[model samples]
Target: MTKTRRIPFVVANWKINKLQSEIAEFLDNVNSKVPSQTVVETGIAAQDLFLADMVRATQDSPIHIVAENVHWEDAGAYTGETSPRALKDIGATYVLIGHFERRKFFNENDSTVNLKVMAALRNGLRPIIDVDEDMSKYAQFMDAEPSVAQVASALAGVSVDQIRNITIAYEPTWAIGSGEAATSEQAQKAAHLIRQTLAKLYSPVIAEQVRILYGGSVTPDNASALLQQPDIDGVLVGTAALDPVKFLELINIAKQPSMPGQFDTDEV
Candidate 1:
């Protein structure tokens, strides 16, 4: 695959944790310290209740507020579901559609995931579509059929123009919250397959342009190796992101220059 200059993105999926008071404290600690988005894009995903507040708190910072999930319809009788339109209106720039937890706990399937992806796009919210691959099966074939299929299904009917606004995250189910992260080589292999899938669905140029992130148990100690992988543009962190200090550390790590051959690019 040819190289491209995709900015590194470090996002924290707070995922149903933190109180209002704790949220305020966390923001106060990291908001002023965050690097400019141009250097390293940063985001924090939290419960729906805290999205608006988080948006306001980070207004002066580069930290983009991300929604964990959004309903397909702009507005409906769907009780307890977040409206994509409302989320956009409330200043959420990004939304996490088809997260592992949402799929595991709330029965989110590929069909529903596609709906949410389209809905988020329709409402001007960029969807960070999560594709959870079961890595234990990775060795059977390097093609990564399940992960590739998930990407195709989630992007069904999405247009080329809209595709630029989307980001794909590969969070292997086995590593998520298990305190074990994929080896750098393993993460790179999965990310490469996802990118290749994009090349087939869209175009090789578009595939290189899209930023793919690695998630599941990412931390400062292990993040550098993962980030240096040619295909991994950034990370979708979980527990480690809960702490303001660790969160800042992750951003700083992303801001560092890539090692030689880590990024091979010519102007797209």
Candidate 2:
């Protein structure tokens, strides 16, 4: 990776937490802590109610605003649903599509994930397509990680340019919020598989350009170890992301130099 290469990306997935006021406070705290010497890109994936609040708070800050979820269609009679256009209009430049919770609780599948991905791109919002493993299939994952089929499906028919602008988060279902996170090596294997799938889907150039993030029990303590991995470009923090101070600590950790000579690596 060169100086002009893809910069490290960090996202805070607030899920169902935070009041509008609290979101403002968190962003204020975070914006203050981001050192002037570093270059880590940051974003907050808050719920629908707080998207505007987050966007307004970070308007002048370097932090990008992201929505936690989105509806596939731009408009219709889908009550209580959020449209990609609405999110973009609200100043959110990114949306989290097909997260594990949506998959498990709301019954989201690859097909819908694809729909949301295209919708986000068309509406000018970058899609953070999440690929997670099902815990029941844990041991089988000893050989298979976030399945190539899963990633390929989410990106089905996506073009190279759009692919380059996108982000993929590999959050193994078993490790998320369970206090038992995947080891850096385990996360690397999964990220490698994702990048491999991307290369095959389009081309090596775009594949390497796409950022693959790890999202599973990420904390300030373990963030540096994970960020230093060759394939891992960033993280999608969950519980820990709720705290502005701790989350900023993780961002600072990401800014620390990747282990000496560790990232002098390329696609396998």
Candidate 3:
């Protein structure tokens, strides 16, 4: 049986942005602003320094709190790193791994990402693994290693059931922070490719069970077009996510009914 979550996920990747004071004000109005007409599994990814505040702010609300990233190890001599235990303690239900920026700036390759994914699962945290092709071509990374490899590597030893806890966010390096989002067709193509790769690595059922979200320059203007794509389960929002009004609009856009052929087809 296909175990794909198939739920519409609207996630906010606050990244390294957002101040404690700004977060406090936003969370105050977010719960009341969420539209009741449509349902979208929404979450906010706060910077490490602000996760606790974000978590506390969202308590008793329908929104879920997410952490930008976390170390793979639960505990040890790894200095200056927050343990998965720490995230759970702070009430972070999800974590991000393998974002293009992390790989570029921190030299985090697929191996470390695999470790992080397993670690997040081990600690009861659902992970949003980012797998995006480096479009800059300045590094020639796409030729060196496709994003698909990163996805496969992250799930190397994860069991079928464990895979369901993972949300694959396909954010290409080019589209992010550029203020220029990919056309809906382009985003869907990448989402489909990722799902197809999952089928090859595991089973069609597990592949379908995995949720895929598109990221990079996701604004309210384009969220509906992207969410309408058959395989696109949701979004890993960036710039617009920092604003409460825009973020709620984006979530409402995702709430709109998806077209037919979104899932029942054979081709990814």
Candidate 4:
């Protein structure tokens, strides 16, 4: 592509799906079939209950494990919440926060997401913060504009080098689970806005270093074109990730060399 320093990442968010038994089988499939030294980095974000088992299964492989969500505190009486320390202890390299389901069903807000991100960083875990472009669904219960702006602001001020350890997922709520994918142009436009927002809040250097991903109904068939977009560093795949062959195919596509006119013509 543009010869960027950051590697391409493919994250599978198996939200509330996959049993422990299934996870073990999936790990085996991944270990045996994964590419040796491709440009793409593979990762899976499983349910909180399966984090330990998943990590143990993928310990020997280069595949990274991620927790679907975690609490802001290290340890306490948070009944249904996962501790960041526990996640790190289990060898989780990444944590996904502010997912669409969490924001829609669990009443999670920007402040809570910010705290969780800070806690994940403090525990030496990378945070993959998810931002949904379609906030119309939450407009009545929450303000779309300021809510998004608050999250952007939170990430901007959290750490000394926040963007370095953070990966952003721009999931347009309208496209999620609808079997419809955003056009390459649409995805690049939104992703560029996210980068611009970061640049405005932080410095241009940090914004350039930060990786922005496109999520929602990403499949093997569409991944190549999507990753070819200049602003799209990677993908946060959902249903397509459930199948081993499909998931690997997506990663393989991302690892392919960029073709002419695939990325931005303006970029060197």
- What digit string (tens of lDDT, one per residue) describes model 3 on residues 1-268? 2222366888998888867888888888688776542356899988888888777777777788888778989999998887998999889999998899999899999999999999899999999999886433323332232336678888999987788799999898888999999888888877777787788777766787778999999999988888888878899998899999998898878777663223542322
Itemize residue pairs with steric clashes in candidate 1: none
Quantify all predictions' global Cα lDDT against the true fold: 0.89, 0.81, 0.81, 0.79
Candidate 1 TM-score over all chains jointly: 0.93
**Candidate 4: stretches off by over 4 Å:** 1-4, 36-38, 135-151, 259-268
TM-score, each model?
A: 0.93, 0.90, 0.89, 0.88
Quote the positional error of residue 181 for candidate 4 in Å: 1.0
* Clash counts for all predictions: 0, 0, 2, 0
lDDT of model number 4: 0.79
| Cα error of candidate 3 at position 11, Å | 1.0
Q: What is the per-residue lDDT of model 4 for residues 1-268, given as tens digits with 9 covering 90 to 100? A: 3544656888999988888888888877878676644456788998877888877787677788999999999999999888999999988999998888888999988889888888999999999999885533334532122234644744845754655789899898888888888987788777777776676666655667777899988998888778888878899999999999898888788777672112322112
Number of the top-ranking candidate, with lDDT as the measure: 1
Output the TM-score of candidate 4. 0.88
Q: Is candidate 2 or candidate 3 better by TM-score?
A: 2
lDDT of 2: 0.81
